[model samples]
Target chain A: MENHLKNLRAEKGWSQSDLAEQLDVSRQTVNSLERGKYDPSLPLAFKIARVFALPIEEIFVEEAEDKK
Target chain B: MSERIKSAGKRYRLEFGAAMTFYMVVLFGAKFLADGVEPGAWLTTLAIAPVVPIVFACIAFFRYYGSLDERERRLMSDAAALSLVIGIFTALTLGFLKSFGVFHFEWDMLWFGPFLIALWGIVRCALLLKR
Candidate 1:
């Protein structure tokens, strides 16, 4: 899954560690998510959306093939 | 997210530590016990080597039962599945070679298999933590 997490975080002037602290996850998780090496779980996605005051779909782009 | 999962993590650490200590003690104790004995003494050490780690891993498994959230559980399950596949493939390949007389079975390989399995499991856990 691709995401605008880094963009959003940057816009908010939040570092990966800051975002991770807010999300209660490790900084590596935030980094990995931003780097597109790992996908966040639904709950984590919700938390990220909540942090940004955006919809989950806006923050996370799920590829059509991944739907299958 | 849940208190149960948090406690499960704590339990896993405790159990892992205990199991490691037990394994070290058993491994070294058996070696010391058989130091002056005749041949086949090393066999006793080899035979007893796997039991501690196996028991430790089992305890970790049971402690995490029903405690992992969806993501944590998925990562763990996938890691274990991968580890099993690797471990089995390596063991089977070596076993086949031994049976074909390509190489004689060395008692050291007995301990080596479990070490590989444990190492794989640890690496998986570390990756999950990294995430």
Candidate 2:
């Protein structure tokens, strides 16, 4: 999964720590999500959507099959 | 360092500490009682007395684990799985070597629990540090 988390966070002028606080997760989780090193569960995806006030698809894009 | 995780960590530490302290006391007490008791069911029961506090420690550990966020939980579960795999492979190898008469010393089963825990701790630290 690819996410515009970094851009979104930057647009909000929120540090990783700030986003983590809002999400009730550790900064490591935020970093991992941004780096595409980890995928969020459904609840966490909903939480992220809620945090950014955007739909989950807007924040997270599925990878194209050809790209794989 | 969310407040929730912070509080959970504190509770885990307290619970683990209390359990470990009790475990040590039970160990020493068992040892003291062992010398005065005959070889019977009493001694057998005394031998395993330390396991009681260990069970509480395990419960505390599970509770702390349940309080972790999803990503941390994934990492922890992965670390535990790796530890178990490594521990099992090592035990199997040692068993095979012993059966082949390549090793003579008895492997202390008591060390297995600590070994797995230490391996998981090391793996978890490395995984977190890599992040």
Q: Look at candidate 1 and tell me the lDDT of residue B117.
A: 62
Tell me the spans in candidate 2 whose CA falls farther than 4 Å from its real position.
A65-68, B129-131
Off by over 4 Å in 1: A64-68, B1-19, B26-77, B107-113, B118-131
- The models' CA-based lDDT, in order, is 0.75, 0.92
> Model 2 over residues A1-68: C-alpha lDDT tens digits?
88899999999999988888888888888999999889999999999999999999999988893267
User: How many clashing residue pairs are found in candidate 2?
Assistant: 0
Tens-digit lDDT string for candidate 1 (A6-58): 89999999888788767766566677789777888778889989999999999
Question: What's the lDDT for candidate 2?
Answer: 0.92
In model 2, chain B matches the true chain B with a TM-score of 0.94
In model 1, the Cα lDDT at residue B73 comes to 57
Give one digit per residue, the lDDT tens place, for model 1 in B1-131. 34445567788888878888878887777777766767685766665775867688677777665555445556667777777777778778988998899999675766776676686779687767766
Please give the range of 10 consecutive residues that has the lowest summed lDDT in model 2 chain A.
A59-68
Among all windows of 10 consecutive residues in model 2 chain B, the one with the lowest summed lDDT is: B1-10
